[model samples]
Target: MLETRSLTVRFGGQAAVDGVTCAFHRGTLTAIVGPNGAGKTTYFNLISGQLRATAGDVFLSGARITTLPASRRARRGLGRAFQLTNLFPDLSVLENVRLAVQAQAGIGLDFLGLAARHTALHDRAMAVLERVNLASRAAVPAAALSHGDQRKLEVAILLAMQPRIFMFDEPTAGMSVDEVPVILDLIEAIRQDRDRTILLVEHKMDVVRRLADRVIVLHQGRLAADGAPEDVVASAVVQEAYLGVRAGDV
Candidate 1:
């Protein structure tokens, strides 16, 4: 449902992503894996409209969105959750999600009513929180929640927007053993919904193996390997570049 055609991103004359071409299809979760500077995140920035590409094009459901701004992309059924938590620290969990719902509804003009006071908005926000398994923390200040909760809150905020394409950049960055299952389960549920194409940029091999239907391996800002997860995992280049050792050699 989303595609990047020979997409390249250059920063100050340094090409961070070079002629990278890939497509993310509906009903499938695609994982982008590579070395630290492999340009996975740069590719995401290009696709999400966070950073304009130096060349090539980005398309969403067949519509060219290369020049579209980030907000416009969000309005056009693209949802993104960053590696770091992006939330209103002082706002309650429910309020934070409500803000996204409000944005989706184009109700940012209303200010007199408390965000939590809108019953419909609150219900919708709660539903999103529930999807992330975070509904119980809805009344707490965002800053007071645990680190894992904060990550879930980020997912909830994106879920509130109800986008057709979800771009998650390191969704399970710093969670404890106890917290990992919760996050993984929530993501699994999202994948099972079969409603959107998910593009996940993650470092955790276990997470990627469990969640990705296909894998694309990048190395030195270029496409090095692209195929089923097992094939990519077993690839010689992928093993040397990102997987820490040669496959079957350890």
Candidate 2:
């Protein structure tokens, strides 16, 4: 579980994320949705340690982690998939994931062993790949995969970390509509694991409506709505401030 209290992220005098409080509970899928510049990603960045909060606290399972470095935060059961693809194109899919598993296993110093010799890491990496439906492409160089496949590979790489909390910023951003389903399905599978908390920041209403157990709407860097998907979707403030259309009209 993760919680942010009065989290504020400012650049100079301008606040990208205003004081806001929210929580992502274990085994649940929570979505942060809003129009462009609503500070959705900014808030996520603060919670995930990509940016330090100007004011407020971030807690994971009741421990304050606001001051922890990104690497330490990640090592403490947090994982993220960036809106932009981050992958080692020159490496094989299996190798990419192997590196992640190796890092998570605290074997980054063990360069003496051939990566292939780490059978346990290899097996676990393959298992994560299988979870994302990328098992068959494990041996292929990451550069050869399609964009959607590459995104799935990114997810697989993050999965290799065995994180307890996952933050996905626009996980389906560049994919075709058809390609979106695969990522959506993969997200659903991960959510059902009942051991991780997922925070999804996405613009696709269809995906949000389908996957979000709870939805929080942000408008102009503030919380505009927070509740069950259906409730938030129908709230007057959410429609007026963000969606610009009543739920029934849409």
Task: Quickly count the clashes in candidate 2.
Answer: 0
lDDT of 2 by residue, 83-120 (tens): 88889999999999998898899887765878668799
TM-score for candidate 1, residues paired by index? 0.92
Q: At residue 27, what lDDT does model 2 achieve?
A: 95
- lDDT of each residue in 54-88, candidate 1, tens digit only: 89999998999999999999999999998888889
Question: Model 1 scores what on Cα lDDT?
Answer: 0.88
Off by over 4 Å in 1: 110-117, 245-250
Candidate 2 local distance difference test against the native: 0.87
TM-score list, all predictions: 0.92, 0.92
Would you list the clashing residue pairs of candidate 2?
none
Q: Would you list the clashing residue pairs of candidate 1?
A: none
